[model samples]
Target chain A: MWSGWADIMDPHSLTKLNQCRRERRAAILLTDLGDGSDRVIVEGDAVDGALGDAVANAFRSGKSGTREVDGRAFFLNVHLPPPRLVMIGAVHISQALAPMAAIAGFDLQIIDPRTAFASPERFPNVRLDAEWPEDVLAREPLDAYCALAALTHDPKIDDPALTAALKADCFYIGALGSRKTHARRVERLTAAEISSASIGRIRAPIGLAIGAASPAEIAVAVLAEIIEALRSRGVGAERGKAA
Target chain B: MSQTMQSAPPKDPLTIAEEWLKDGKEVAIATVIETWGSAPRPIGSHLVINKDGLFEGSVSGGCVEGAVVTEAADVIADGKPRLLEFGVADETAWEVGLSCGGRIKVYVERLG
Candidate 1:
């Protein structure tokens, strides 16, 4: 039953796993408890049987645990990239979000065309890009691991980044605006050729409806929402209870 | 390029292990494959050991590391993997202070 266990740890496998991690790719390091041999299975790599199901589950759950398959135990160590929070405006809410997001383990970045608001004095120790979101995002493309918050009320600054985030399949895309404002913005995006379905993914009024009236409290709501979106990814609609 | 914050500010054990391998040092990687009760570290926790007994990471709350490191040297020399189990019930574990009423299985193997 334990014939599948291979003792040698493949050097190339470790190298490949590290490369996958550095590239922000999801992977699983599967170690056979029978013979102590292991290999790294990337997210899209195909596998069959109970182990395949286990791998898929691990990827979705982002969990590490031992599994028994055909009387052989295997340890699946899941590695998902750290989540990123990209804010379109380095404004008051972002100023509050910058530190809170960092403490919450989100790599936060703020981009705004206005240098006055995006200055070091405002967002110290934060990754502040004093440039248009389109220009900054063109170089640093968004991906599934990223959560983009379009805080700039200006459509000129927010719309292009929202389109990019939607196109890149960002895990969470939120825009700061009221329901009425979002309706108008939706019309503009539709005029700009963005599909309604894609536009619908944006969370307008961008927060967990916690009655957050202040900038800092609103920042809390947005960060909580982003966390919810991240933790619930691929897990269906199992959302956390709102505070 | 956009100044997006990429936070890997501190090097983790696996990254250090890769670096040690690249630097041509003989290394062994010990992982916590299983844990029960109040094991301080969770499963998949890594403790990497180099030839000179220098190590990074942790498998327990400062317990059983010395033994794991000693065992790691043998793994590095022989290129054979080893599975080590420790529990509070064990005499050595009681002596070494894994007395947190927990158990853990560590798989140690040479990393090329």
Candidate 2:
């Protein structure tokens, strides 16, 4: 007997089953019937037993269904939110910046090769990747909303991530270094064939020149710069619309 | 019932009245309704005093707390609200230490 019980009832599967069984709850999907007109129709309880199969059948047959409960039909639009901040260091600044980013509605993830530095105790509420930046960041999509910061001064850590970030057109790419260090960084990137225009996109001194001497003060400066960049982008977008 | 007489956290003289009535305790709330010259606390400052002489949230520094608390306890026991004024100009005000020469009017209400 091939019953639904054959699969262990995980929360997701259980939710789907429960949604199908409840008459008041409806599963909505936009569909086009073969009549050249796209209209929504409610599914009945009989189709509940094969809800997953029905959805698959609709897609396979190029048709969709809109389930109705209490005369209201909702169309599901699966829009994924953007990728978040990908910090390439597990330093003290990252520790302070992670919580502030979380509060500002960022999905914060830290990537560092050092296992001791990326431990859970240091970053209690952040996602930690104990792999090198290039390996870890390669798994994630870097969209325009994505923020990538290279907090490590080491070329081994910063170089690979900066290369990836430049290729991806990440919205914000910042590297923490002194003026002299950034000069050396530019020379290194030039050797790697990154153009001056791409290098200009980086906030090399990493923060507003606030004379920050402590990790906490530096974190504030970095966040302030990020906020200013985001705001300037927004203003430019609005001006483009006015034109 | 007045709007301030609603049973909520004491916003003013009237709200404190309702809170005291609900708790079945004699209490006084002193509101800094008006102030002149350099005052330590601004207008709308509140100090709540119960019949037991316990209080919360300050209205002034050491200069006025003792006298305000005493006056508040008296108002709570009397079940009458009175506007009490004190400042550096008043002869007895020196005892309360408001020597900064600022005048303040406190509305003391028996919140019972």
lDDT of 2 by residue, A1-243 (tens): 122221111123323323432332223322111111111223322333343344434422322224343343312211113337888899999999888887877777788898988888898867888888877767764655577889989999989998888888766889999889999999999998999989988998998889888998898888877766644443444367569
For model 2, how does the per-residue alpha-carbon lDDT over B1-112 read when each residue is reduced to its tens digit? 0122124433443334345545766656566656788878866466877787877666666678898888776665655556678888788888878988898877665432
Error of 1 at A196 (Å): 2.9
Best by lDDT: 1
* iRMSD in angstroms, per model: 3.2, 30.3
**What DockQ would you assign to candidate 1?**
0.52
In candidate 1, stretches whose alpha carbon ends up further than 4 angstroms from where it belongs are A1-5, A236-243, B1-8, B99-102
Index of the highest-TM-score prediction: 1
lDDT of 1 by residue, A79-135 (tens): 888888999998899989889999999887888989888888788788888888888
Which stretches in model 2 have alpha-carbon errors above 4 Å? A1-83, A234-243, B1-112
How does chain A of candidate 1 score by TM-score against the true chain A?
0.90
Q: List the residue pairs that clash in candidate 2.
A: A31-A64, B4-B15
Candidate 1's residue-wise lDDT over B1-112, tens digit each? Answer: 2444445478888989899989999889999988999999988899999998899999996899999999999999988899899998898877878988999999899886
Q: In model 2 chain B, which range of ten residues has the least summed lDDT? A: B1-10
Judged by DockQ, which candidate is best? 1
lDDT of 2 at A239: 67
